[model samples]
Target: MNKVKVLLAEDEASLGMIVKESLESRDFVVFHAENGEKAYEVYQTEKPDILVLDVMMPLKDGFTLAKEIRLENKHIPIIFLTAKSQTSDVLEGFNNGGNDYLKKPFSMEELIVRIKSLLNRIELKPNIENIKIGNYTFNFTKQTLIHSSEIVQLTHREAELLFYLVEKKNEVLDRTFILNKLWGNDDFFNARSMDVFISKLRKKLRNDDTIQIMNVRGFGYKLLC
Candidate 1:
C-alpha cells in the first residue's frame, strides 16, 4: 500500500521536527517546509495527500497559501495550526479553504486524529451518475454543479454535504448528524464550519429559485425542490 503523504509547513524548528518524525513513525511520508513559500514549492513538486500548515509563518501566511492552493486544487484537504482561537480566526481559516484547524499547544494524538479524519473524509469512491436538482445537474464523482453553460466546482466537504442533502431531499437533516458525518465531530468550530459550507451551497444553488436549502429552526436544514 502507498504511504500517506503529508506536507507540514511550520517555522518552528523543534516543533516541525517533532511533527515530521511523529508522522513518519506512523508510516506517513512527510515533507517538511520552514516557511509558506517553501511549503508551496514542496506542494507543487510532491503533490501531497494532505497539508498541515501553521497560520503565522514567514514569507506567506497559512491562509494565503491555502487560498493559492485552492485555486488549483479544491479537493485537497488542508488543516491549519494557529495560536489564535477566536471565532473570527477559525472562520478565516475555513474561508481560505482549510478543512480543519488546531489551536496551539495541542497534543500529537489530536493532530494525528484530525489528519486521519480529514483523510478518511476525502477517500474516493466509485463514480456515480449525475442527478438533477431543479435547473442544476450535480455530478458527485466530478464534484461539480452544472447549470446551462456554467460549471461550479465544489470542494470535498461541499460535495459531501450536497450529496447528503440530495439523499434526504425535503426532510430536515439534523445538524448534529450532518456535523458528525462530515466533520467527524459536532464541536463549535466544526459546527460553524458546517454553517459556512451550507451558506456556500445556498449560493451555488441560487440559480434556480425553486430549489431551496431551508434552515430549520433548532432542527437542521431541508432541501426543498
Candidate 2:
C-alpha cells in the first residue's frame, strides 16, 4: 500500500515538528514547510495527497495558498489550522477551499481523526452512480448538478449534504443526526455551517419547481419532491 502524503505548513516551529512527528509515526509521509510560499512550492513539486495549513505564516497566508491551490485542483482536501475561531473566520476558510478547519492548540488525536475522516469522504466507492433529483442529474463522482444546459459544480461538503438528502428523500432528517453524521459533532459552530451549506443547496436545486428542501419546524430538514 502506498503511504499517504501530507503537505503540512505551519510557521510555529515546535508545533510543526510535533505534528510532523506524530503523523509520521502513524505511517503518513509528511513534508513540513515552515512558510506558505514553501508550502506552495512543495505542493507543486510533491503533489501531496492532502494539505494541512496554518493560517498565519511569514508569506502568502493559508487562505491565499488555498485559493491558488484550488485554481489547480478542485477536489484536493485542505484542512486549515488557525487560532481564530470566529464564525466569519471559519466561513472564510471554507470559501477559500478548506474542507475542514481546526483551531489552534488542537490535540494530535483530533487532527489525526479529521484527516482520516476527510480521506474517507473523498475515497471512491465503486457502487455510487449518478442520481436523478427532480429534473437535475446529480453526478456524485464529479460533484456536479446538471440540468438542460446548466452545470453547477458543488463543493465537497455540499455534495455530501446533497447525497444524504437524496438518499433520504421525503424523510425528515434530524438536524442533530445530520450534523453528527457529516461533521462528527452537533456543536453550535457545525450546526451553523450545516445551515449555510443547506441554504446553498436550496439555491442550487431551486430551478426545478418540484424539488424543495423543506425545513421542518424545530426538527430538521426534508427533501420533498
Structure candidate 1, residue pairs in collision? none
Residue-level lDDT tens digits of model 1 in 22-70: 9999899999999999999999999999999999999999999999998
Clashes of each: 0, 0
lDDT of 2 at 78: 92
1-225 per-residue lDDT for model 2 (tens digits): 999999999999999999999999999999999999999999999999999999999988999999899888877889999999988888788878788888888999999998888888777433355699999999876778999999998876787788889888999988888887677678988988889989999999999999999999888899998
Which of the numbered candidates is closest to the native, going by highest TM-score?
2
Per-model TM-score on C-alpha atoms: 0.85, 0.89
Candidate 2 backbone collisions, by pair: none
The per-model lDDT (C-alpha) reads: 0.89, 0.89
Model 1 residue 24 CA deviation (Å) reads 1.7
C-alpha RMSD between model 1 and the true structure: 2.5
CA displacement after TM-score superposition, residue 210 of candidate 2 (Å): 0.8
**Residue range with the least summed lDDT across 10 consecutive positions in model 1:** 120-129
The list of candidate 2 runs beyond 4 A from truth reads 124-130, 217-219
